[model samples]
Target: PTTTQAGRAKPNILVTGTPGTGKTTTSSLLAEATQLRHINVGDLVKEKGLHDGWDEELQCHILNEDLVCDELEDMMEEGGNIVDYHGCDFFPERWFDCVVVLQTDNSILYDRLSSRGYTGSKLTNNIECEIFQVLLEEAKASYREDIVMALQSDSLDDISRNLSTLTGWVNNWILDRSS
Candidate 1:
């Protein structure tokens, strides 16, 4: 039987993208609108004391892919989680109903990163990552093509629309799975 919207099971969602692409913003919106638990990986790492600083220690820890996977699996076991991260390659496709990849104009991304205190090497590297479509490629390779989507997040209205579209998709996912 189909549950009422109030009793609907929230599907696991992966909101990912390159830096300055609004992954965090979109994930927050979805969590607010759908009442799902928001699991921002950055925050999780911080709370876990996984890394000490942004130096080599932190860099090495964050780059440990296996550790990230294990931690994510543990986190998702509680159910109804929105895993907000920068890429999707490490996550299992079977666990996620949808993966929304947020995208932004290169110029806008450069501006956003610049305003956020990134400069020189860091900003240039991220711009290159976005240009090369690293996150998009990761999503495509790691997830079922039909479940992965690229969305533009150039403005608040765009984010709102994306959130609505994704929420509706989650609802449909639940209905389809139950049938």
Candidate 2:
């Protein structure tokens, strides 16, 4: 059953992109504006030990996808979740009403990643991911095309625009649910 069918008044949104693309910032702001719950998957993975182990080369955790899904299943069903993560393919397609894949220019992304101390293969791999639009492809593959969108996050203005756009979408969703 859908969240609406389950009597949930709000929708679940997935905010995904390569590192430094502002998934957390966007999700947090969106959640604040809409009074939705923001679940930063990276932080949840770390805090809840929802991963097999850390990948030293990647300088990140090896996410246990099944565990992540299991942990989020209930909340997702109840709706009103803003899930922020880099990877998207592993999540259940039914979990999100909207899947937003944030895209950033290579040079801008490079600077952001570099400032975050991302170097060597970790940095290169992420830059290449953005260059190739890997996350957008993953989201499209994992969800219905109509529900997935790629949004720019190259500058503060872009983020502001995205926030406004998504907030309006949320309002429309609520109205749709009511009707």
Candidate 3:
């Protein structure tokens, strides 16, 4: 989609939530349907070696927030990128036209995480984070309330509904900006 303002031809969408909340899944479908580039932050961190070092305990890399933003700033400004990550506060608030935080029921989340082999502290921390709606609250705090929304990802039906609703919204945004 093209924007009225030159050099702003696309919209940046951030799809974020606690782990196992389906941010990647939703963003993937959205990208396919909307023709946006899907950038999984985790994959980016790994590919670009943007991480500081490995976290043996958490079993994940320690990402450098500054480096990540620097590396992605250009694409973000050019727009039409759907960013999928569990955390959002570190990203510049202005980078996104919309921030979607997917939510899942605790039991459903537990099952999903368990199936992924998340155990003990890691699993518990993630579940607690979901229960507390940390990602949703963070999105709201980082961006205008109108631009940040909490979407349910509890089932396939919910995912379908979300995709339809969000695709419509994206279309409207493009039309509005272009006009």
Candidate 4:
């Protein structure tokens, strides 16, 4: 959707990926550099009690998608938000101007998840999710292909490069909206 339709001067971006793929770090830094609000959906779910219940197998909250969407609707309509989440299919497509799916190499992702104490089915499922590009595909299916991008997130350099690319995009978005 166009910024004009939302009456927004800035854009809303969704940064998503498999767990340990740097969605939080990238979105946090991007928000700091671009002055956009960073909404970590996981954190939001916990903070707002917007969940059905805990998922015993997943070791995470069973997010109440409707509640989460309702909570975010107004801010999203106003734009200038960098939403960090692992899954994308549940979010409303119109909430974002750009969708970034960060990908990390399988081995690196394994190590990262391992260090984070992820084990058994949780770790195995996440690794498989990355290997299969689940999140990237979900984003593409959920949003316009032109607005969805997959960026590397295996190292600090990659994160820096992504930040630069996204910062430039943000500038262009503003210019395009203004003109």
Best by lDDT: 4
TM-score of candidate 2 on Cα atoms, chains taken together = 0.95
Candidate 3 C-alpha lDDT tens digits along 89-155? 9998778888999999999999999999999999999999999999998998889999888899999
Q: Candidate 2 lDDT, tens digit per residue, 87-129?
A: 9988877778899999999999999999999889989999999
Better of 2 and 4 by TM-score: 4
Ranking by TM-score: 4, 2, 3, 1
- The digit string of per-residue lDDT tens for model 4 on 27-142 reads 99999899999999999999999999999999999999999999999899888899999999998877788999999999999999999999999999999999999999999999
- Pairing residues by index, what is the TM-score of model 3? 0.95
- Which regions of candidate 4 are displaced past 4 Å? 1-6
Q: What RMSD does model 2 have? A: 1.5
Q: How high is each candidate's TM-score?
A: 0.85, 0.95, 0.95, 0.96
User: Please, what's the RMSD in Å of model 4?
Assistant: 1.8
Candidate order by lDDT, decreasing, is 4, 3, 2, 1
Query: How does candidate 4 fare on TM-score?
Result: 0.96
Best by TM-score: 4
Root-mean-square deviation per candidate: 4.6, 1.5, 2.7, 1.8
Residue-pair clashes per candidate, as listed? Answer: 0, 0, 0, 0
| Residue 157 in model 3: lDDT | 98
